[model samples]
Target: MTYESSASAFRHLLEARRSIRSFLPTRVPDSMIASVLQDAQCAPSNCNTQPWHVHVVSGSSRDRLSQALLAAEAAGRMSLDFSFSANDVHGIYGERLREQGAAYYQALGISREALAERRAASLRNLEFFGAPHAAFLFMPVFGDAVRVAGDIGMYGQTFLLSLAAHGLGGVPQTVLGMYADTIREELGVDPSLKLLFGISFGYPDATSAAAAYRIEKVPFEDSVVFHN
Candidate 1:
């Protein structure tokens, strides 16, 4: 493709990509999954360490992992390699987070006061929102938080974009990392590997309520810096 055409296609792809929360039960083909992973492998990493270690679960394995995750959540069992503070999400970031939550709940017809409903909805993350497959992303710590996290972030974006390119959809769920101990035990993963997140992927259920919602992005001017 020519330069202009290439840029336009890329822009269109980026604009069209969205987090699909609900998916059809139909399984994605193994060949397609392999192809997507191949594309994701091209993602650049700091010093080419290429530290991402992924575990893709499907069929019975997916079901069992979901059940374990749900049980862990219900029992208040959480083991996180990374710390997250609610206090850090203050000011503008917090407002945007709240706004996104409101939009998502509204689209799903969930009431803010319905604690049970909220919990049920949140539990869907463990179920991979009915998707046929889930991939757990893990990486070994390099002692440098910024570089390690940055590599994983690039890898994740590449993986998601590859799914989109293949006419599939995916949603990244950090909540899955909360049950790291359960996941490690169940999947036979090394405890030394830190769980970054999980992604659920498959053909999207476009008719679902959650699929109809799209969070708006801030203006380019607000995020970009044009330095002379």
Candidate 2:
């Protein structure tokens, strides 16, 4: 591809990529998954430590994990390796978070005052939003784990982008990390690896409410201050 074409394609991919909350039951081909994983391997990391360990669950295993997650959630069992709470953020960050949640709930046609409905909607994350596959991302603790987290984020973006390029979609679920102990035990992951987050992926359900909604980014001026 020429410079202009390459730049256009790259920009298109970046702009087209977004979180897909609901997916169809059809599973993606294993070869396609392999291709996306291969492309994602090019993601850059801090000092190239390459600390991400991803386990992709599908078919019966995926359904079984969903059951286990539901049981753990019902019993209030949350085994988090890192602290995370959106409400803890203040100012613009908190406002943005709230805005996203409102948009999502609105799309689902669930009123903010409907606590039970909202809870049920949120619980969909445990079922991987009905996607046929889920990928749990884990990392070995290195130092404070801050740097490792950043590295994994890059890896995740790359993986998501690759999925988009292949006509697939995915959503990253932090809620899944809350059941880290359950996930590790079910997947037989090494004890040393700490859960970060997970990605639910497959063909997006275009007829679903989530497919019609998106959380727009804030203005460029609000995010960047020119130093030059």
Candidate 3:
């Protein structure tokens, strides 16, 4: 692909992708998700090791997973395997995080003082946010973390873009990591392979409150740096 065309295609993709929160009960074809996963495998890796393993859940599996997650959360047995820390919260990225966090809670009618409400809201993450499909991406430690992370990023982008291309929508969820131990045990992933993140996929539910809650992205110039 030529540089111009490649840039144009990427631009289209950016405009097309959305962080879909509400999902339709209308089922998405398994083959479609499968094909997207196939494309996800196109991600580059160090030494072609391709260190991503995914587990897909839907139908009964999805329901069971949701039940397990709710149970774990209710029992206060949820372990924080990977979670965001507010250690350094004075930088640009920190500001961005705060802005989004405030916006999301406001959209959900959660208040600043409602810690229990926020915790309950967070538990929804393990429910795959009510989407029909939940996909977990894992990376096994084989020595080099940087290279594997790069590969994971590529795969994640490919998976999300492929879903958008197929007229489906999803949200890449890091909150799933909050209950990573429960999920890991439930999924029966090998001890070697670690959970990197997750994505919830399905047709967008236009009527849901979350569907209406949206945010605009920063302009391209503001986000990008140019050097010539």
lDDT by residue for model 3 over 136-222, one digit each (tens)? 888876655667867887888889998988888989887676677778888897767767778999998877767767677777798
Estimate, for each residue in 35-59, the C-alpha lDDT of model 1 and write its tens digit: 9999999999988999999999999
Candidate with the larger TM-score of 2 and 3: 2
Give per-residue lDDT, candidate 3, residue 107: 85
Misplaced by over 4 Å in model 2 are none
If candidate 2 were superposed on the true structure by all CA atoms, what would the RMSD be?
1.0
Candidate 3, after superposition: displacement of residue 168 in Å?
Answer: 0.9
Off by over 4 Å in 3: 1-9, 80-83, 88-90, 113-117, 220-228
**Candidate 2: lDDT of 28?**
100
Q: How many clashes show up in model 1?
A: 0
Q: Pick the candidate with the highest lDDT.
A: 2
In model 1, pairs of residues that clash are: none
Which candidate, 1 or 3, would have the higher TM-score against the true structure? 1
User: What is the TM-score (0 to 1) of candidate 3?
Assistant: 0.86
Model 1 segments more than 4 A misplaced = none
Report the Cα lDDT for residue 222, model 1: 92
The superposed Cα distance between candidate 2 and the true structure at residue 177, in angstroms, equals: 0.7
